[model samples]
Target: MSVDDGILEHMFESDFASADDKTVVAAIEECARAEAMLAARRLAATAELTARYTEPDEDRDHLAVDGWRMASAEISAAMRVGDRAASSQMCIAMALRERLPKVAALFAQGRLSAALVSTITWRTQLIVDSQIAQRIDTAIAQRAGEWGGLSVARLESAIDSLVDQHDPDARRRMREAAQNRDVRLGKRDDVTGTMSLWGRLSIADGELLKRRLAQLSSQVCKDDPRTAGQRRSEALGAIAANAEGLSCRCGSPDCPSAGQDDPRAAHFVINVITEANAPNTEPVPATPAESATAERAAGPVEPATEPQAAEPATERSKPRSAAALIIGGGLIPTPLLAELIKNGAKVQWVHKPPAAPETGYRPSGKTARFVRMRDMTCRFPGCTRPAEFCDLDHTTPSPAGATHPSNLKCLCRIHHLLKTFGGWGDQQHPDGTVLWTAPSGRTYFTHPGSRLFYPGWDTTTATLLVPTGPARHGDKGAMMPRRRRTRAQDRLRRIERERALNAIDRKRWAAPATTQPSRPPPQNDDPWKITTDANIDTTDTDPAPF
Candidate 1:
C-alpha cells in the first residue's frame, strides 16, 4: 500500500488495542471531557433560551416571556437527543402557533421550579388527546391584561386551582395511581409490606427476600469470602444449637425435625460436621489452656466482677451498645465528645491515628455512632441513606478545624469516597447548605429539601438513654440497662437496608455507585418484624422468605 493508504488503514485498525490499559484510560478521559463539553453546551443553550424568551425587566410582560422561555427550555431539553436545527424549527413553529400567557404568576411566587414549569408546557405541546393543558394556557393568555403582571408560578398555580375546583379527584386519582404504579414496579417498597407478618412481607420484606435470593443464587459457586447468608446462618447456629434437643428425626412433617427445613442441607451438613468435630470444650471444672487463652484475650477476670445475681426475664433482648470493649484514652474535646454521649453510640478503637495524609483515617465505631446519628445520610443533593449505614464525613479536616457536630455529616460509603477522593468540588455554605460543582461547571445545591438535614430522633422512650453530660474523665455515668452488646446480626440488617436503598437510587440515576439499591423500603412498612411504635426490630427479624 501507498503511504497515505497505510496511514488510513492504521487509523481504522490500530493495534493500539481495543482493551489496552493505557488506551482504555485515555479513552475514558476523552469521553469524560466530551461529556463535560456537552453539558456546558446544554447550559449555554438554556441561558440563551432564558435571555431570548424571558423579559425579566418588564413586570407586566413577564408572563409572555415566561411562556416563551418555558417553551424554549422544553424544546431545547428534548432536542438534546435530536438534530438541533430541526428541533429549533419545531420549537419556533410551536411558539408562533400557540398563544401563551405573558407572565406565569405562580412561578414568580415560587409555586414551581423553572424546570417543572417548562416540563408541563412541553407535555402539553406533545399531547395528542388531552386539551386540558392547552385550554388552561389559552385561558391564561386571554387574561394577560389582568394576570399578565403575575408571576409564571402564580399563573400555573391559578390554573391548577381552577382545575382542582372543577375536578378535585382528577389530581388525587393521578397521584394515587402514580404512587400505586411505583409500588407495583418494585420502585416503592413501603406499600408492598405493612402487616404483622403478611403486610410487611408483601411490602419491603418480599423485595428484600427477592434481592437476597438473587444474591445467594449468584454466590453459591464462588470461592470468595463467605456470603452474608453463610455468616448469618453460622451466627444462628450458635443460638439454634439447643433447638435440636426439641427436635425428633421422625420422618413426619408434624415432627419437630420439620422445623429444621434446611435449604442447603447437603453441603451445610458437611460444614457443620467439620465445625462440631474441630475441637471440644475443655473438661472438668477448668482447663489451663482455656484459662490462658481467656486471660490473653481479655487480660484477667477479676473475682469482684461477679454482680449480685438477679432473676432472668422470660425474653432476653439484644444489647443496646455494641461496643467491643470500653477503654481509656486521653480526653478528646468535650463538645465533640458530648454530642456522641447524647446519642447512644459505641466505639471500636484502632489505638492510633494514621501517620500519612494519603492514608484515610476514620473515627472508631463509637464516633461513627455519633456522626452517623447526626447527619444520617449524604449532605449532597438528592442523596439518601440512613445514618447507621453512613460513613462519618468530616466537613472540614482536623488541624484546620475541630470535630464538632456541625462539621460532621453521615454520608454513604460512595458519597464519602467521592468527596474525599473524587475530583468533585464540594463546599458547605455558612447556612449549612452543601453545593457541588460538577466537572461541567453545573452547580448542584443541597438546600432545604435536599439531603443536608437529619430528622431528629426521639429515643427517650427506649430502655437505653444516651446521657446528657458535662463530661469528665473517670465518669462512670449511667450504665446501659442491658449488658448484651453484640449487634453484628443487626449490622447485617442495616447492610441489607443500605443495599435495597442503593438499588432504588441507582435506578434513579441510571448509573449506580454500587450494585446495591439506593434506598430500601422504610422498615416501618415491613411485615415480618415486630412493629411497636412504628419501629421494626431488625435485631431478630428473619431474612424475607422468597
Candidate 2:
C-alpha cells in the first residue's frame, strides 16, 4: 500500500488507548514510514536549493567554494542554524542525489531514515571511482533497512568491511588523534562555584600524573577526615599551587607534618569582583569542647574574640544572594565569598572602562582587552567561539573604518571568511550590538554576551562618523585559495600508495613453500650419526630417523 493511503486511513485515529494492540502497532509502523518519506522529500528539496545557487559548470569542479558558501549562508539564515550545519545538509543532499542513486531510491521509498542516509554518505565519502561507489551503494541499500537495530559502532564496522573488500584504498584514513590532545575547562555548571574539568593527554603522561596524585593522597595521617577521593582532589590543587604535599587535616600536635610550611608553594592571583558595602560579620568564638568537635569533623580553627549576631528568621529563610563574581568563573554565593576571603584571597577593584575609542588600523591593547571582556564570545549570531580565540574584525574594512571599539567585533575564522568572501554584510552599534546581513538578504541582530552577566557595565563607546562608500563587490575572477593538490588528485595518489603496499604484503603471505634439499643417511645406520657426503642419495619416502 502507498504511504499516503496508509496515513489517510489512520490520520484521525487519535484515540490509541481504545485501539487494539495490533492496530496501534500498525499505526506506529505507518507513521515511521511516513516520517522517512518526509525526510527524503526534505533532502530532495535541500538538494534542489543547493543546485539553484550553484553554477552548473562549476558543479563538476568542487573548487567553486564561494558558490557553496553562499548557499550555506542562505540555508543558515533560513533554517536558523549555523553555517557548518547548513553545509552538512547540502553535502548530504548532493551525495545522495549524484552518487548514491540506489540508496536514494530506498530512502524515497520510506525504507531508510535521514540519519541512516547521512551515515551512508559520510562512510562512502572516500570512494572517488564512480563504478566502485555505485557498486557499494547498491550493496548497502540492499541491506540497510535491516540496520536499524544495530549499534552505531556495529553499523560502521559492517559498512567499512563491505567497502574494504571492494576498495580497501577508499576507506577513510584514521587521523593521528594523539596529536590533537588538549585540556579544556567546561562551562559553569548549574551549581554555583563549580565547573567541570576534562582533557586528553598521552597515556604515559596521564599515568604519571595519576601516580603522583595517588602518592600525595596517601601522605596524610590516618586521622585525616577527608575521603581518598577528596584527598586526591586536594592533591591536584596542591600541584597547581606548586606545593610539595597536601596539608594534613588531623589537627594533632603529634602529626609529623604539623606546623610546617610548604616552601615550594607559590603565590597565585585570582580576580574577583565584589559589591561594595557588603555586610561583614565577625567569626564567633568556640568553647574548648566545641573546638575539639569541630577539629575532628573538619579541621583546626583559629580563635577569635568577637561573636556573630543572630540574623532574623525572615532574613535567614531567604535564599543566599550572590556577593562576588570570579573573572572566568560564575557567581559566588555570599557564604562562599566569605570563606574565600578568610582563606587569604586578595581583592582588587577594577577602574571604569575607557570611554573613547582608539585611532589606528589595529586597536590598542587596552581597547582590545575591553572589547574581549565586553563581547565574551564571537558577535556572529549563533556562534559561541570564545572572544579570546576569535579575530577582531572591523565592521567596516580598515582604512575606511577606524580601530574603535564600536567598529571592532569578534568573529571566528570561518565566519570571518564568510563575511569577507561570501557577500555578507554587518554593522556595529556603540552599545556593543551587532547587526548581520546574510547573503540571502536576511538580517539578524546579536547583543554582547556579557549583558547577561554584567548588566551594569557600560560597553558604549563614541560613535564615529566614518563614511560607508558604495558596497564593494567581490571580483568575479577571484577564486578560493587553491590547495597544493586537488582532492581528486590527493585521493588517487593515496589510494595508489596504499594498494601498492597491500599488494606487496599479499604477495609475501601467498608465496609458495620451497622444497628442502635431501640429506645423506648415516653409513653405519646410527640415527644420531652426522654425515657430510653431499653425493649420497636419501630421497626415500620413509620418515627421517629420530
Candidate 3:
C-alpha cells in the first residue's frame, strides 16, 4: 500500500507528465493562487501595524504649539472630504469644545503660540455665547476695512453708543434736546408756511430711530416732507394743548373761530391765533384799512377747499383719431410685430368702425405676454432695457401680415417713434444682416460677423456683408437675395467629403495592425511626416497556417 500510494501522489504533484507535455500546469496554477493570497494577507497586516504605531496620544491636547499646529492641519485634512457645511460647524464646535480653553489658558499663562492663539480665537468666536458674539461682531465692524473688518477700539466705541442710546436714563437728555429745537419753515400752497420735523442720526442708529419715529409720528403727527423743526413745533404745540388747564377754544386746531365758547375744543383757537400771527400766512382780501384791521381781529380765515377749473363746452365734442381707437384696446398680433421690428416698420392702428362687432377686432392678451417672454429686452441689436415699457411694433401693416414670431421686435419708446413716425426704414438681409435707411436716403448696414444661427434665430446663417447704398423698405431693399440649394446636391457634396475622411480613418485604424505603434513626434521636429511600412521576411513558414 505505501509504495503504490507514494507513486500516485508524486505523479499528481509533478510539474510535467513529460518534458513535451504540461500536465503540471494545474499544479503551477494552484501554487500561484496560494502565493497571491499570502501576499495580500501580508499587506493587510503591515497596514494594521502602521496605523497602531501612529495613533495619537490621549494627553496630546497639552502638547506644544507645533503639536497643535500639526493636529489642526490633520483635522482639516480629515474633514476635507466630508460634507462642507457640516464639517465647518463641526470644526467650530471642536475648536470651541477642545482647543479654545487650552489656547485661552495657554495665552493667559503666556504659554501659547501666536499662530495657534489667533486660529483658536477665531474658531472659538464661532461658537461663543451671544454676549461674546456681539463683541466679535462689533470687533469685525470696527476694523473699518473694505467690508467685514472691525478693530477692537472702533467696536468698543460703537458698543458704548448703543448702550447709551438705549439706556432709560438718557431719556431726559433727549427731551432737553427736543425742547431746545426750533420749527423748520417750508413752502405751502396757502400763504402760511408749513413745518417739517425730523432729525439727523448716526448711521448705525439711524434706522432704529427712524423706525421709532415713524411709529410715534403715525400715532401723534403728520410726516409732511416739510421742515423737521416745523413738525417738531407742531408736535410740541399739540402736547402743550393736551397738558392740564392751558387749552384754548376752537373747533379745529388752525380755525379762525378764536375766543369761541367751546371749553372741550381749546387747541383749535390756539392754532387759529398761531396761524394768524404766522408771517407767511395769506393776506385778507383788500378793504378799508380800518375795517380790515377789525375783520382781522374778528378772525379772518379762508375756507379750505380744493381748487377747481371750469370746462369749456367745446371739449366734450372733440373727436379722437382712428389710430387711437385700435391701440387703446390692444388689438394686434405679435409675429407680424417682430417682423415689423426687424424691418424697422411701425403701425398706426385705426379702428375701422366702432359700430362693427367687438369680437371682430378684439386682440388677444397673449400679444403682450408673448412679447415679454420672447423678446425680453429691446430687439434693436445692442439695446438691452426690459421690453415691458417698449412699444410692441408690427413690421408689416395689420390686415396685410399675421403676428408671427418672425414679425416682432421690441423697440424702446424713443426708437419706436423714431423708426415708426420718424422717417427711417430698415431691411433684413438674406444672411440675417440688417440694413437701415435714414430719412436722407443714406443706407447703413449691420454686418453680423461670426454670428452662429440656430433654428428660430431670424438673422442670417452666413456672415453678413454690408452693402454700400440706400437700403429702402419693401422691394428696394431686396438686394443680394440668398441663393437656394437643392437637397440632392448638398447630400452629394457631403458624401464626397465623408469619402475623403473615411479613407484617412481606414489608414489610421490599419496602421498599428500592420506596424509598431507610433511614438510622439519629437520636440522641435516637424509634425507633418511621411512614413513607409517595414517589410518582414516570411520565406520559411506562413504566420496564419490555421
lDDT of 3 by residue, 207-227 (tens): 674554443333322323435
Model 3 — TM-score against the truth?
Answer: 0.19
Q: Lowest-lDDT window of 10 residues in candidate 2?
A: 304-313
The order of the candidates by TM-score, greatest first, is 2, 1, 3
Instruction: Give the Cα-based TM-score of candidate 2 against the true structure.
Output: 0.63
Q: For residues 1-546, what per-residue lDDT tens digits would candidate 2 score against the true structure?
A: 357866766755655858899999998999898999988887888888888876544433344345666677777666667777888988899889888989999999999887888888888777778999889988998899899888878888888888888887566544356957988865645567555678899999999999999999999899999999888887887787677777787889999877654322223122222122322222133332222101011221221111111111112123223234433345555554443333443322222235565656887655665676567677777666666678999888776777888888888777787777666789899888988888667898889866777675556777877675764545733645544544445556876775566556556657987685466345877767666556667676455677
Task: Give the range of the ten consecutive residues with the poorest summed lDDT in model 1.
Answer: 267-276
Better of 2 and 3 by lDDT: 2
Off by over 4 Å in 2: 1-91, 108-110, 171-206, 219-225, 233-355, 364-366, 399-402, 452-468, 471-546
Query: Whole-model lDDT, candidate 1?
Result: 0.36
| Evaluation by lDDT, superior candidate among 1 and 2 | 2
TM-scores for every candidate against the unseen true structure: 0.24, 0.63, 0.19
In angstroms, the error of model 3 at 519 is 99
For this target, which candidate reaches the highest TM-score against the unseen true structure?
2
Q: CA lDDT of 539 in candidate 1?
A: 68
